[model samples]
Target: MHPESEDDSLQRHRLHPSSLLFSFLGQAKQFFLPFLLLFFAAGDSWELWFALLIIPVLVFDTYRFLTMRYRFAPAELIVTGGVLTKNERHVPYARIQNIDLKQGPIQRLLEVAEVRIETASGAEPEAIFKVLSLSAVQRMRGRVFAERGEARPEDADEASAGRTEPAPRPELINSLGPKDLILLGLNPGRGMGVVAVLWGLAWQMGLFDGALNFESILKFFTGSEEGSVLGYSALALGFLVSLFLLSITWHFLRLFDYRLELRGDDFLSQGGLFTRHSTTIPRQRIQLISISESPLQRWMQRVSVKVETAGGTGQPAESRHWFAPLIHRHELQGILTTIDPHLQIEQASWQSLAPGYRYRMHKLSVIIALGIAAICQLIFWPWGWLSLIGLLPLFAWATQVESKYIAYARTGYGILFRNGAFWRQMSLTMNEKVQVVSQHQSPFDRGHRMASLRVDTAGAGQSGHKINVPYLPTARADELQADLVAAAGRGEFSW
Candidate 1:
């Protein structure tokens, strides 16, 4: 009674019953927002239509529940079902890049979680278990890595039978408490939510076309003349207040009671308020680790660390990154020790780019800022001169930012990149994740005998998948590219 003795040698199993709840919710989401709008438009009359839609959603959920089936075959994981079209797939363990666990409000309420198994083929997950218990997820994770030569299958034998023997919760290596969560809520990066709200309002008001007057927005928020400092102060305070309330709600729901653990073979995380969750990630599946902080986080002396997998889509809330999202800066070393002793980023001496690197590094940002200043001057006349004053300092600040934070270093495993001024990021990647390394030279760069290194990896989004290190000596860029290419060849690889 062993798995993989033959190509199709295991029993088909249905997901947890809570999966039906998840499936139904997925269907309801399609029409939920529209229903809400209709409710506002037509009052209680929309309830009947909303209830009518529920019937179809229920039917679809039941149909999916009846058809969906997965099998734990040793060599490959198989998923098959479809009442009509007859869909089926076999994802070999060798191609199974990473497995991620996620939970939404409902799934958390039901005390079950979703498991996403990905292959390097694309951003879409290869196998999805909508709802499974913590014990079941641990068993499945064990089975997956067992096939990958990273764990043992007998550990999941209890899973083959129906039992709830939860795996031992590993000892805490690092964690975030209430105070840290509060600081995370107050972090400046969260202010983007308020900015996005204003931008959306402006777009709706036709401000993108230069139709709306800026003074009117100021008047709407603060009833005072443009010359009054109280008017500007009130407006800024209002936005910050809105940002605080929004961020507090979000961070509390997402990171309340957060904890990180290491169970020898993998790292595990569980957190949330109304909707709790448990996530497991095999150590070898990790492609990169990022340690970062926003201006506010830096000011508060805290950091957020994210773990990226080779198969990630890199979308917020959906990506498998951020296994440990936020913690005090001092605790970073304690957690790094669990992941890998060699990944002590604080100990690594990073080599900064040349002092003149900002000539190229700040080129795009300066262009954008100057363009905004020009538009303000054109539209607002004499008053626009004030904007140029602010823009000038910001433009000058870029060089200082580059001098302080922009740099890269070679590591024993791969390249380490440090970038960003306001939202600082430090990424350490292993050679195995690198797919290609290329050198590029711009006309201006060649004049300075400089070039940039572009690294392509599986763990990247369309934009960030290609890592760029700008303003390096041409000889150094060429030499580093050759060395990286050679190292990539020597390292283990998989699709």
Candidate 2:
């Protein structure tokens, strides 16, 4: 439904002054342990003075609780805080990118949701509305959308400009069921095994203790020598089994209560256990769509679909932002057609590497491996040679994979990068999202008429979204760079 005139429909709700007390209490709790430790570490006189100091803090908190004001206007939310500095924040409806509703265990017990509104300003500023009722949060969402003049997916357009009517709810085209959930769980793209292995390695490196506590358990299993061989073997077998089971269970539970509902132009996915999350990805916001399958997943006939959005969270250090874990590779086209009929799935002929390019790349890998081996030899002669030998085969295998798998496809709207060593990846990005494009040629590559094309996009965590086509013809790379720059200037972004 469209919003009425601001003068007629706009209303304001001020938060209860008591909220300040709760806020202060929450902040105080964060420092409670530290304060307690300090009190014990200090002498009785210092402890007594510190205890007395709490009186003024408490008095100030009480005063703030009785005077603070937080107002939610129909078109915007304003928070004016602090007794002295008077920090004021104004968040207008139009600028908000998304509203995130979060509830911790304590907040859940209190029947309150913390509303976090994310904006497009690169600073990542968020306005948090704490201890809000669920109904209130929903109402806020509706109001903000209304103020922004966003049409509901279900809305029907009128030929006559004067008349306005509410839009009917759209019909559900598809919904994920138990079978879909199971398939999603079984999807190889979830990389639970990889995650577990990484976890174990990190634990060994004393990084942090995560879901898999391998160190302590392994120590316990191998601590004694009386039945060391038998015990160690049993422990290893059990650990492997447990790891597999845990991965499966965690993957399954991740989508246990998963729900996807289509309402016009937007797709909404809601799922999670402890902290439920709902993501609304509008079709227009999607910059790229990729369907990828690792060797194992390809054998199992499964592929993962990844949709890259403009403002959503980026992938973790070594992970992907996938829409769904495991759909059969053959079914990806059908799924995309169902989601957006206009989306094109094209297979273009990929340019192959020149003979010299392949030879140079392989030589680089071999030299790097030998260099590492030489360094190792200086440190530990016999074992270092073995280490160098071990490194040789891995480098050789990597070189082979790089030669076989490195390819790219350019379509009318976007480019796709296909690469893999053992784990395959297909990354797609539209021409307009290419914020920067450049071509570079190494001396060796120049002799072969080959150059590397680099494409950069927004918000890819540390290094951002950079894709390099290693061995494309210099002319082709230059042409692509020009096209991407032109498209970006024209603002013709597409998914």
Candidate 3:
């Protein structure tokens, strides 16, 4: 037989030697706090015991590095490793949904990356090659796509020859400029979440111990015991300004130079300021698409697009599920059509909820308002009663306005559901992607002869969006569920 070529040799090789360093760092990062605690608990001569403890860790790492091996077959990837208990896994290329790569400063310098291969079977990645050479990663990507018959021209070269030419520019589907990123920051204003994290960290570090308190902050904002409204108003304004500034900064750092591209059968998103990040979503694997607009986003005539597939949930920022982080409102249909020609949201005939839906909402709102007002009165007395008056009228007006916009539609290919008052979200699920069709009625719904319909697909819960239509006439809900079930049955589900 002829000598095995370099590419063939790579097919059965172990991970690069750098894997040992990364594996050790990963272990240290995970157990640093625990080990530190133990170090202190062990007293002054803790160094000896600490060093002894680490010997076992070093031995385990060495054993793991020596034993672990992977092979690329024509149809599947075979990974085998473990010392005490040998383990092997065969991951078929067709079942793979995502192959995400991460490169921090050091990894980039070393021309290596941490690769996570995901499939629809579970929440976590199916295979994680902690560290691999850049060339190896390229070959892996090429082989995966090639085996699935979705490989681009360059993918074939990288897979077979372990070399690639300069890539042709991909089709730009959508991109976020500075203005769009700013708007995204303003609308989502996600930076407020950082305040809690910072506060926790500060508390843990003893920075807040006897240094700051809620009472002091209240006094600073309100001034004298009388609690001046102007002072509190100023404090509120300052707080909001801080949140907005933080949000803008956070967005810039995480999503700087964001762009979404369509190359062959894949959707690629790339962004980040310090460490570049990218995510790839295969076109055919998309199970659900959602368009959402917050009150601020709507006012600005902007919306965000997100998609879900069978794989990946609670992923890191680099592997997020956003299809288009932000896009102009008018571009919604155009973008949808570009993603898939079959999507026609504007053409679908929408149907509002059943009659008395508003009445039901108003009744529930009154009960909630009364309960809140009673609890407040017990705590704050006179002024608390005023809340009920305000809440009742507010709820009445909200229910009236929101009931008009809450609706669902049976599109030719899938189901579309839209709801929300201040923050509206519309979601579409193709019939072929639907995994389950469910109908239910609560006591209140039964009283009004109403029911709810929910269509679930893979990654449904992970998307933070669902096709659940409420307050439909029981008959309509039943009819919709049956129709959806029939349609789903007709089309074979793809990953």
Please report the candidate that would top TM-score against the real structure. 3
Query: What value of lDDT does candidate 1 attain over all alpha carbons?
Result: 0.71
User: Total backbone clashes of model 3?
Assistant: 0
User: Each model's TM-score?
Assistant: 0.82, 0.74, 0.87
lDDT at position 399, candidate 1: 59
Which digits, one per residue and each the tens of the lDDT, describe model 3 over residues 1-495? 112333553467688889899888878887788777777777667454664676688789889889888876656788899989999999998898888777776787888888888887766898888788888876776677666754344444445565642233579998888988888888743335567446544654568658676446757767676546776567557766777777888888878888888766777776777665667688888888888888899898888998876676545332337788888888999888877899998899999889989888888878988998887687566777888878888887777777888899998889999987767889998889999999889998999999999898876654276898999999999899999999999987777
**On residues 399-494, what C-alpha lDDT tens digit does candidate 1 reach at each position?**
568568888888777888878767787777778778878888889888889888878765664432225788898878888898898899997775
Report the lDDT tens digits of candidate 2 across residue range 451-475: 8887766544342234677878777
Error of 1 at 464 (Å): 6.3
Q: Is candidate 1 or candidate 2 better by TM-score?
A: 1
Question: Which candidate should be chosen as best, given lDDT against the real structure?
Answer: 3
| True-structure RMSD, every candidate | 4.7, 6.0, 4.4
Q: Rank the candidates by lDDT, best first.
A: 3, 1, 2
Q: In model 3, which residue pairs have backbone atoms overlapping below 3 Å?
A: none
TM-score of 1: 0.82
